[model samples]
Target: MESSFQSENENSFNIYLKDISKFKPLKREEEHDLIIHVKKGDKAAMKKLIEANLRFVVSVASNYRNQGMPLADLVNEGNIGLIRSAKRFDETKNFKFISYAVWWIRQAILQAMSEQSRIMKLPLNRVSTIHNVGKVVSKLEQKLKRFPTCDEIAKHLKIDEGDVREAFAIGSGHSSLDSPFSNEDDGSLLDLIENEQAPSPDDKIDGYFLGNEIEDLLNTLKRREAEVLRLYYGIDCERSHTLEEIAAKYNLTRERIRQIKERAIKRLKHPSRNTSLRKFHQG
Candidate 1:
């Protein structure tokens, strides 16, 4: 199945004849003309314009490869940004398309990075802070011989002291000791630290297993009893309904539904001892 899917994808790619030979840097005049064509709803012109700018997308996408995402995925996301830019590209705005599109491209890539980082299960804001803090720390360390102080880092990054501390704490906590918090790392300081254990896998109560168990348990019930269980736990029943709701569904009084529910619960909780089955008392 996977091989068939790959073959289909390859065939589809072959249909789109990508002429990389005509690909040159889009000059200001060329970009302006393409914008005019795009505004006039010429999709072919837009495609050509985008193709010419694929190098720019690649250049921007390459910067984000360090964030532990596939470069191909980033480029694909950047292409999405490029398309959005073409769609929203306004000539009236004094900005050049390249200039306007750069921000859009970065936004698209960063947003994707944000989502990818969330697989770690950190909060959105915290993940964003981690990236921003790393960038700030890297730049500051490059200029200064030693690591910058927290106050200096905060002031330089234009973020609050609390946020800086939080970012640093999260970064340190997330990172291995071998990983430098800043670009500059003293061997002595690095040696004192130890890598924390990776988080344990989350425990999820398997819904499929629970559902199957419920189905098997329901099979032990009579037809009416099974229907009652289905109504209480299946599509028709969203909540733990009151006897009044169940009674209304079954066209009976609340008292009648109550009696049925109680009987069903008792039978399910404590089966009768007979030739076919054994009694199992439930707490």
Candidate 2:
């Protein structure tokens, strides 16, 4: 039964590949029309748009194969992004659909990878921010002919020094705990480290108490501000959303969304408003 299942999977994958290959990519005019139809809720147009872009999704997904996820899974995630792009595509913008869709595609794939590939999963916004920081670092390195310092990178990226440091720390890939210590025949690194499973009883009590405290604090803000902060931080949701996404949901511009978020953060950071949350600011 296992052998038969494997054979069937291989055949299915081959068929999918063949179908994608037959879907010649849409030209600019053709894409515009299909996008119009998609906006009008045409299922056939939506399907065709996605099918025509499956190969593009595959191409993009291939770039992430080394991130410890299967190529097929990455492509599946990319296809989800592609479908989202189809629904959100703005023909009035006059930009190519592929150009707009690429961001969505990469975002979905990276979100999936961050959740699946790590035992210590970082928030989706942090993962995205780290990738953005890396891109800035690479460009700066090419221009300056050396590795950039945290302060320099922070200045270039227009983010805080602490944020840059955190990004670098989290983006550093994990290593096996069983790896040898140096080139010597000494015991593995795992032998030197102690593993702690669940949180302590005191810690659990503190965490529960703090969670209620934070939720109460969140209620102090206006409804829109509170919702924006919760969604941005994923305080109660599965994942944080990008500013652009929040902007779309609110029917506002990205800049407007950023302004609202910044204002919300400022309100939260006010000493009088968040006096009980002082521990959050302490190291």
Best by TM-score: 2
Model 1 clash tally, residue pairs: 0
TM-score, one value per model = 0.37, 0.43
Off by over 4 Å in 2: 1-11, 118-283
Best by lDDT: 2
Clash count, one per candidate = 0, 0
* Residue 246 lDDT (model 2): 73
Candidate 2 residues 1-283, lDDT tens each?
Answer: 9999868876887788887899987766687899999989999999989998899899989998877876778889999978967876656642357755765677678667765655257677797778878788768866874446667888987889878766754453211112232233333322221113222232112123233444666777789988876666445443455555678889999899777866765665565665554443231
Report the number of backbone clashes for model 2. 0
TM-score of candidate 2 on Cα atoms, chains taken together: 0.43
Q: Write the per-residue lDDT of candidate 1 for residues 1-283, one digit (tens) a residue.
A: 9999867765654443254435876665677788899989999889988898777787888887867776767878888878877866656543346555664576567656655655388887887877787677767855884446667778987888778766654443222211232344343212221112212112231112122333455566688766764554321231223344567788999778756755654565542311112111110
Q: Looking at candidate 1, what is the lDDT of residue 12?
A: 53
Q: Kindly provide the TM-score of model 1 when superposed on the true structure, using C-alpha atoms.
A: 0.37
Weakest 10 consecutive residues of candidate 2 by summed lDDT: 173-182
